[model samples]
Target: MVSKTDDKKAAPAAAAATAKPEEKKKVVSTIEEDDEFEDFPSADKEVIGWDAVEAAEKELNAWKDSWEDDDNETDFAVLLAAEKKKVSSAMKM
Candidate 1:
């Protein structure tokens, strides 16, 4: 029943109806190889002064002394309150 002209017109319509829509791919840009180390600074080559070293040692010694004093105290209530406060703060975070 179809003529050549009618078949030609219907051919395109039929093809279009059966064809699936193309999915668009997302493009993501990556950091260039040369810029990988650009965010970090160069290694420090300078020597630390003796005064700064002595001060750090003193601070660490003070912390050790405080820890020893705490060990002698054996206060369960204070330890429990500190733990509860730490847990509450962590939960909030």
Candidate 2:
């Protein structure tokens, strides 16, 4: 009993209904791709706030100063080694 025009309209409506979930999936995929690198943060660890960042910066400055002053190569080497270890461990988290 449906006319050709009515069938065409209904077909498009049906297709659009199916496409909505596909559209949602596409949007979710886009979000996932955008956040690919966002998985580094861990639920158990406290968020690295400004204070932690500042502390790390101070430690790095100390290391740099030791390197520049050349007052003790052993101290500078120790600082350099500790900094490398800290960085490598943080990268695993």
The candidate maximizing lDDT is 2
Worst 10 residues of 2 by lDDT: 38-47
Clashes of each: 0, 0
- Top candidate (TM-score): 2
Local accuracy of candidate 2 as per-residue lDDT tens digits, 1-93: 333445546665566548676654665677665544433223213534466565456443434434366544587688998999999999999
TM-scores of all candidate predictions against the true structure:
0.21, 0.22
Candidate 1 local lDDT, 1-93, one digit each (tens): 333544545655555435522211111234354344432211211333465565466443434434435443358867887899999999999
lDDT by candidate, in order shown: 0.47, 0.57
**Candidate no. 1 TM-score:** 0.21
Candidate 1, residue 69: how far the Cα is off, in Å? 24
Clashing pairs in 1: none
